[model samples]
Target chain A: MLPLRVKSMPADRKGIRVDLQLVADMIEPGTRVLDVGCGDGTLLDYLVHFRQVDGRGLELSPDGVHACISAGLPVIQGDADTDLKDYPDDAYDYVVLSQTLQAMYAPKAVLTHLLRIGRRAIISFPNFAYWRVRLYLFLWGRMPRNETLPYTWYETPNIHFCSILDFLELCREMGIVIERSHVLDSWGVPRMMGRSRFLANLFGVQAVFLLRKSG
Target chain B: MGVTERKSTGQAPTSLDGTGPIPGYHVRLGCDSPLRLDCGVELFDFPTAYQTYGRLNADKSNAVLVCHALTGDQFVADAHPVTGKPGWWEMMVGAGKVLDTDRFYVICANILGGCMGTIGPREVNPATGKAWGLSFPVITIADMVRAQAMLIDHLGIDRLFAVVGGSLGGMQVLEWAASYPQRLYTAIPIATALLHTAQNIAFHEVGRQAIMADPDWCGGDYLDQGKRPLRGLAVARMAAHITYLSESALHQKFGRKLQDRKAFTYGFDADFQVESYLRYQGSIFVDRFDANSYLYITRAMDYFDLVESHGGPTKLFRNTPVRFCIVSFTGDWLYPTPENQKIVHALNAVAANVSFAEVVSDKGHDAFLLDEPDFHRVLTGFISGAWERRQGHAAAQG
Candidate 1:
């Protein structure tokens, strides 16, 4: 085993992905957070170190769990599809699903569980209705393979891909309250597009939303 | 000469092997500071045998205690003094392994109720001047942790870097976290559960009964009678051994394979390879382990339930400053994954810092001791990260 040196330098939030940075910004210090599909737990680590949040993570793969644990992040090896039911209601202040909503087997059920398990939920996913994706799918009768959606039709883990408007409609039907939303370009740069929901759906390559239970 | 002189001390009517101090690596507690067992009895002059590796840095912040499982001794990273076999946990406690003796002070002790140069049923009771035997107070997992805490106090370290263990050893680790959370920075409880299940208790009962039913057992005074219940202990070991292995593993290793002969013996002899292997395991085990020790230890485990002591399972870590890594094996029915998840769920309820890993392996309950790279990888990461967190905490305090 490689000997790991404890590096005490403060987390450099500037180097984090733009969407993740935005999500991190919404979380309050000292609150409990659970990151679903927390790949290697970079966001959880950042939240713990910089935001002083009580952070936890859940990853489906053993390798990702090992990486997270090795870094001293609290992570459980579990699938979001079924493991969410085991968590107590309002167990966390914020439940995060960054860029992993599309890969879920039942996105709607998982979304409902996120709201049920946390006071607020943060979800980020590629928007299939972005101009480039729509044009690629419209021009070629194949699944779009672009900068934001890179995997091919057969090998992609994005089984339930949806547009930004589709997600809003889902929240509407499930009685979820969308407290805040953000948009990002294909390059992961923050975009000022959520001002007009329609234009954001048409132009934004990715969408992130902070949601809460309506009742 | 030493044995005869000590026998006449005339305090108790206990069996006397030898009176001149125990001959191996050990720590003796004096009568002035007796170990107060959970049973409300104060055990005096109790000796705890332990082995340590690596150097303890000046600040004494790098000490790591590795608790051994049932049938395991203090030979964590060295050759066993009795069997000449490599240490039980050499895979994860050596120089370059996850515990990494080169970087931390690693210590392993024969548990309080163990026979290997420790205060167990084989030890003479000073009060009665006799082999405690069946008279040795039944020890609980918490009692074992208390003894370890004394050892730690004796070592002069205020706090430990981490406490780690698997199976029965894992119980000790859990008890340490619950009873003395401030004494250790982190805990790694592998292939274990929050409590012993009814199924687990039933299995242990079968083994204990097997030992007690043996004629040569002499009603737990087999030592004074100059006899060992080899047959009964062997049978008990054989039965318990099956629980440590998975059905898939057993099938893959010895599925109806005949022993030495092409066909089964027409009589009541060991014909199958699995039977022969089990017989060999049982016969050799009796040579090193005492049947009475097995009874006491199994009883201790059967009585273990963290909820009973800490209120509820979820309340075990309430308001505690402990970081935990709980691991389980996919094929381990003895202490299955769901049981381990209960622990993780409890930790989560209290918002305690915890991680849970369900490793894929066919080695059953023994997987934690095997060469599963995923287990090692998880430990390596957990320990390194915990160390880093400790450093961060120290920096903040400064």
Candidate 2:
């Protein structure tokens, strides 16, 4: 037998094309993966099948669970708002929060849980510091609703929004370590994602960072 | 552990072995023999009429079990038996497709309550020398999964690559995870909820009432009368079918489309196109399905609530060490995305590994049964991913 991981990788490789390369570069073989707010099990699926990582995902929808089940993918039906406490400390190789930080009620608590439960954590989200959002606030003086934040003010699910600079500041305050970082476009094309950390406050549109708890 | 329980690998592998036999039909493995339902009803030596298009690898690590919804047969990607129509999910399962049978061993079964070639009210009871009728002991979704687990065991497969289903079939998938998490590497539940909410129960009750109200239905003894509960079952189907559609979809498809008459008919003869379409659907369904099975099955679904069964807040799987992926459709008012969201929230409470997707479609609860490209893509990706995880674990041991 070629091994289970190799057999499962090719299908997953087809879906997470761009992200697959990125995950392969970042993750080592045999790592345990926990992905919160995993949409359709895409990233976790990629990491597990392609990068030889063990995957667990948290998603809060039935249809999502259904598709996941039909595909024979493993996942849990859950929300990041309240489900973070279920994990034991230092149980995972990595905890990942991807594109979900801005929608949280308590991003800090979630990040703390990730660091506590895993050796390292990956956090990614749209940057509220994006130039379009800045222009909307600066020129139109509105809450800056665009493609990422399309819903009306009353209906938006995003209760809190933070920029890359704001998130890094929080990390610094908590004495966290940034192992690696990435930024991507809407199409998930990686660019100068972590360049100019100091100026990322005004110019960064997306951010992905690896964090570890301060010892 | 016993000699009889050993897998019969020498048996002539049929279409049920998880491979598609013909075009437009995706095949998966089915038990070469019959299954036993919790109702003490042996499927009376029935064949698990399934089709698979993929090859089961030597270690059986590529197997993915597909559970069908209510009214769904095992012919997931082939022509329908009676209607001669295309398979329900031909788009999602095929060679080189998202659920590509060429890659993974996909297995689908006609659920116990189904009108298909599986044991139901239509099948004769071995002890009684007559159809089981309403005499069949009621079955829960857990019972359905239990039966499925038996089929999986029969194949010499130690663990399923994944378990996937929609609607009632989705219920079985969830139950499989809850009751036997160790057996499945992953679970994908689409368009199903952890519980049957009050509103859903009410809808089911209405359908039931419509079935029993017919004069032909002699309480539970009408099967011997040679007149199946056709009128009642048709009406039941018609009423329940409306809930499967969204208001937006209904409005777009059949809003005030007049029948083949310029003027309104004074009599109640299906005055509108919507009315005629519904009538056609109901009448057609009655021909292919057994009415008593419908009653027993819907009752089972009505009582299904995973949280309630788990005693409260279904995060019992926090330590189960399995993964999940949940899919929902925007227009599926039957199970609704909110119900799926509730499940996700609960899994989140336990910090379990899970994923969520709300595919944008007007197909309602039936979307999972259709040619949804997005659904196929996500599912194919997830299964391979779970397999890889198992492989990595194996590698570490070496």
Candidate 3:
């Protein structure tokens, strides 16, 4: 067989999003990783290429799954809410679920399954309690529409939107330890959310947390 | 098993136990070992007709077995000898197509109860030197898969990279996943059901009764009596053909249009273009297909229920290492999306690596057999990704 052309991961290593790159940086090299809701598998491509990790993905939509396959990524078409229970305990080193927590049917159950399926689970979601969102509700008395949370309430797929504090509380209740965290502004630029968790919860547009079992 | 590696010799190396690498040729296996059938009968020296394309790699991990549908044959990407038409899947199994004969060793075989060169009702019985006819022991999807496993063994390959099929062929693929999960790395079952639905079985029964009612059928002994049940077989084909197509397709192609004329004849002639089309389909089918084979194969398909005797579908893939890609079409009411979804859910419950694609096509159950662009893209993407992953795994192990 001839050499395979590595796609998803470009040679320049500049294609990945900043938030995704932060998550990638936290993952150790040569580990098995599963990316839940991995759309187009861009992060997986980057991980497989640079980090030399065995990467797999679970995407719900057909287009995303096909795109991932087109990029030669081993991604399966499955829902995060219901399908996570099938995975054996600690089957992966790192299971990453980015920007898909809000749309889940049962966020807590999915988060619990994630903690059990991988040694560490990385999750990123838009914080509904951000200052801009809070002000939009306080002043206009309607659901906030922004770059990340663009959908109206009637048409929104985010059935269980949560804030950074809500997520942390659930993690605490589940006895999951937050190993690392990154906060991004509305523009996806990493902000000081890492330094002060309180201010981050109040102002950060997005939050990414690296979590593990709190033994 | 002898390893006949013909490196750069430009000839198929012959194995000591089995015939050489006969690509594009069908091998009639005289099964030295008895094949115990699901019907509790053992077939002694049954034949399995198969065709192959591309070269088997040195490691033999790139072999893909393409199972054919109820009426399909071993000609995956070649011109059918009788019909002179392009192979059934010519669009997806050629040089640059999804299966990509250039990259993988592609093998397709006529099933055990099939008429096209494989052992069927028409074949002469080794015991009595007469056509097996109704004497042929009833076979199931599992039996067909067991026969294919023997062929794979004869080819001296330990594991198949993939097993792929649609409809009844998909049943065989599922059977392979259940019976010999270790022998396959990936399984793609498209536009198929886990078992024959009541409605589907009703359809098959209607078709079967059409063949049986004909006096020419002569109690399944038409061959000895020098008779052909063309009328009955044609009727069966015509009735079953409707199920293969969707109402929307029918409406689009020939929506009450008169055949060969703008005005209706009002006679018993094929006034609607759809009738003429169905008649044409039935007439052509009888020319190439055997009536008795139709009876046996449809009976086998009707008898198919994977979970019941197999200890449920989840158990089938409980610890399976195989990955699956299940596809269903929107307009395919024969198997439907819900049927495919059931299999997908089972695989999910077992934590088996699986994917499901509900392709939007108005072509009905035959969508898998058609050249739908989305279907092609999905298949190509899945196979390519699987190949790359297999390569990565091998390289990592090294």
DockQ score of candidate 2? 0.22
Rank candidates, lDDT, best first.
1, 3, 2
- Give RMSD to native, each candidate: 5.4, 9.1, 6.2
**Fnat for the candidates in order:** 0.72, 0.41, 0.42
Task: Arrange candidates, best TM-score first.
Answer: 1, 3, 2
Tell me the deviation in Å of residue B84 in model 1.
1.0
* Candidate 2, B216-321: lDDT as tens digits: 8777667677767789999999988898877777789889888898878899998898999899989988876677878888988987988877667745565766
Q: List the residue pairs that clash in candidate 3.
A: none
Best by DockQ: 1
Per-model TM-score versus the true fold: 0.89, 0.70, 0.86
TM-score of 2: 0.70
Evaluated on chain B only, what are the TM-scores of all the candidate structures, in order? 0.93, 0.87, 0.93
**2 against 3, candidate with superior TM-score:** 3
**Model 2 clash number:** 56
The lowest-lDDT stretch of 10 consecutive residues in candidate 3 chain B is B8-17
| CAPRI-style class, candidate 1 | medium
Q: CA lDDT, every prediction?
A: 0.84, 0.71, 0.82
